[model samples]
Target: MIEDRPYTGLFVLDAGQGVAGPCCGMLLAATGAEVVKLEPPEGDWSRGLSVRKGPESVLHAAWNRGKQGLVLDLKDPAGRAAAQALAARADVLIESFRPGVAARLGLGPEDTGPDAICLSISGFGQTGPYAERPCTDAVAQAFGGLAALNQGADGIPHKTGPFVTDVMTGFAAFAAVQTALAARAQDRAAGRPPRRRVLDLSLLAGTAMLLASQIGEAALLGHSPGVPNVPAGCYQGSDGLWLMVTLVRDPDFVTLCRVLGLPPLAEDARFANFAARSTHAAELVPMVRDAFAGQPRDHWIAALQAARMMTTPVNSPVDWLADPHVVAVGAAPASVQGALGAVPFPAVPGQPQPRGAAPLLGEHTAEILSRLAPVPG
Candidate 1:
């Protein structure tokens, strides 16, 4: 068993709700932090998502595992007091409430112990016109300029189905927390205050940062170019499955031509080089697509591999779970359970599995609160 616990002995207060903040907490707990997920008396809203087995939803269970569950309604004075007490004792506190809500509730960074790392996560960040707006994953995608990039040309902007921006924000928060921890440590060694070591992060910023390359390309080129060259997208194989083939260089085009049995294209002057092939892509791509229609997906995949060209069947999520490669990789969950379950929880490269079951709503509140008795100074 690979036991990964770099953040061992670290206590984390997860006061955020929904995907991004909760995901941040999950990543932290997975890295060996003792995370306490503070939710409302009812439950975290994510518990209402995906397929549910009893009180637990797969989405909620998956992210909340390896953490103690505590319920506190910040709207209630007593609840707010409990939250403050927890924050005072925590090594880190994570909150995703709207801009000023945390401060109003008396659980904001300024309210926490000077050394506690308070990470505030939001859709647009802690300031700006959109900061206070109610934001979702799709909203962030559109606001961050990423939704406009789902495709090119046809004059339609589409939002990605996955909560890509949300997940990205979570990852950004994870990295920020680690960095903050390191910074605070260094500052303390230098006899500086730890409170000066961190700042909040936003989903919009994280998503936009991911577009650095694309934004640069758009600026330099001045026109949207879908994919370079031709036959570089999804196509239907004879077996009726979609396959993607990318031809980055001239030799790749030559190999693709040979595998598709369009040997003429390999020598054709109109398709001689990348620029020529791209210019005549409309003519060559359709012909190549037609050729691929003559062979099953496996036949083309094998032939393309044999020819040393790039080709792969585009798989749906279910298909991916059943894929031989995916199964061999331990990518999919062995089985979804409330806790780490019997399966090895999938982790980021080099990170070990953090183990714990998703607690029932407020399941640990009494125990957590009971254990919070004043420490002898």
Candidate 2:
């Protein structure tokens, strides 16, 4: 099946660690490329990133799955020779070292030749005032102003769970590479000489791009985006289950009031218009909350949904994983036999079921080195 893939003939050398760089290689492998993950004698630090099972960690296994693993300490002269040799033969080379590290190791554009595409993933990109600063997912979020979008009622912001910035950079890198390669292909076919291009992406830029809408609202409207002037917010039901409700159009308030058995709210002079309802939100919210507190969440969800109001339970991750809609979508398995027992992968549109499990540290070192060995005359 891999042999018949879109990138069957492509070769990718992944020298990056953790989520961003490995994710880029994982994406390439999914499309049928032969991806060789270059690691050191100590292995990728991500091997210890999550709980371990035997020789592999779930996080390491999930992200590094579907690639051949090769261990070479580029800090050593011999290791650098092997790394440069591999880079010289690769179609694509991806790294996440600090700005100048790859060039110092001889794996940069000059070494990869004019046809190879080199993608550099960093926290603040290769050229910036903060280029030398070390950054991780949380650091990028805070610096990129992504945390501002996740503020609570107290106005205190929070970094999101897991590697949001790192993962976004991976998605961005994939798209950028495809665009660059397509343009290169066109250029070469038109008789223009091929030139090696270095693609630079930063977690800062990727995370900022994801916050475009929220930032736009803050910049253009002088306020953060929010549900404007309506009876809308999360409320606790009788069973203590939380659900969100929204009144979008003016008529939605009428529908909501009728559903909650408070039909008079629609015509009450004190709460007649959107402005009145907003002004009296503190007064109105409790009435709605009390009405819901008399019933289980499902009852309100059903009634509000039937009335065409936007309402939904604030489902937990576990609830969403078992949701009927999620099952019907069918992109992910309930669980996979990962290096660390049965681990789950996130549901992504069009992601091929992992064709291979994660490789052990230096697992394919012998296999890869033999392939790169010089030919005998």
lDDT of 1: 0.80
Candidate 2 stretches with Cα past 4 Å from truth are 1-4, 153-155, 222-233, 246-250, 264-288, 334-338
Cα displacement (Å) at residue 211, model 2: 1.2
lDDT of 1 by residue, 1-377 (tens): 57667898999999888878888888889888999999988888889988777788777876677889898888889888888888887888898889989889876887777788888988888888888888888887887668777754476888887778877888888888889888878878999755733468888887888787777778788964444667677778888988888878878888887777788888999988887877787787789889888978888888878877777889877787788987887776554465434433355556565466777889898899888767779
Across 1-377, the per-residue lDDT of candidate 2 in tens digits comes to: 22345677888999999899898888888778899999888888888877787778877876777888888988889889989988998889999999999989978888896778899998898996999999999988988777876786688999987788888899788888777778888988998988887899999898988888777878987876553656788888899999999766788888888899999888888778777887687788788889989999999999988877888899987787788987787635644445466666774455554467777778898988888787999
What TM-score number comes out for model 1?
0.90
* Residue 162 lDDT, candidate 1, scale 0-100: 72
Q: Candidates' TM-scores?
A: 0.90, 0.88
Q: Which 10 residues in a row give candidate 1 its minimum summed lDDT?
A: 338-347
Per-structure clash totals for the candidates:
1, 0
Per-residue lDDT value at 122 in model 1: 84
